[model samples]
Target: MNRNQHIWLSVFFSLALGLLLWKLKLPNLFIYSLPMYPTAILPDFIEPALDPNHRKFFHSKRMFKFLVICLVILLLLASFKSQHYFFWFFGVLGYLLHLIAESLTFKGLPN
Candidate 1:
């Protein structure tokens, strides 16, 4: 997918997550969604979309799993009220959502 498509998907995902958090009475809703926009397009920034086959290491399944693990760790750290937990949480959440969007495309992310 293109950059614009990625951004829209990210926004949709963030909104859904925000709604869920709102229902759960989670605090700092703004902080949770703040970092998503930039981080959603971060893979492209890290590995530019020069061609159709540009989804390499940074956009791979391995990286997705790594970020999932990081997300879990951030959640754990949030219990301690870590000062920067939500920043990292939303950042990784955006990256994960990006990969999910890419994986839905015809040219899915690499293994």
Candidate 2:
């Protein structure tokens, strides 16, 4: 339940949830709009910007909760507009699973 454990758990849970969602044939859950040609690995460039230690906003629980709320609202909006809701639901569920897994590890508490 240390930092390493937390990371591993989060990764495992996320991957498992992603696999499950993929099996369910959901769409738009994993889509990203990036330039066709990338100069570097996307995560490497993105992770530091999103890293908690770097004062990233989304790294906090409050921000995460806010995100969930926003996602739910978006999902409802999509449903109202007759758009697909499967991906939204699946994506939120997967993110929540990752958060929960991280919570179970020691890293859940503030340093």
lDDT of each: 0.87, 0.47
**Candidate 2: segments with Cα more than 4 A from true spot:** 1-57, 109-111
Native RMSD of candidate 2 (Å): 7.0
- Tell me the alpha-carbon RMSD of every candidate: 1.6, 7.0
lDDT for residue 18 in candidate 1, whole number 0-100: 83
Residue 32 lDDT, candidate 2, scale 0-100: 18
Minimal lDDT window, size 10, model 1 = 25-34
Query: For model 1, what is the C-alpha lDDT against the true structure?
Result: 0.87
Q: What is the lDDT of candidate 2?
A: 0.47
Q: What TM-scores do the predictions have?
A: 0.88, 0.43
- Clash totals, every prediction: 0, 0
The digit string of per-residue lDDT tens for model 2 on 17-79 reads 556657878434434111111211222233343443432343447755865796788678767
Best by lDDT: 1
Instruction: Name the runs in model 1 displaced over 4 angstroms.
Output: 81-83
Which residue pairs show backbone clashes in model 2? none
In model 2, the worst 10-residue window by lDDT is 32-41
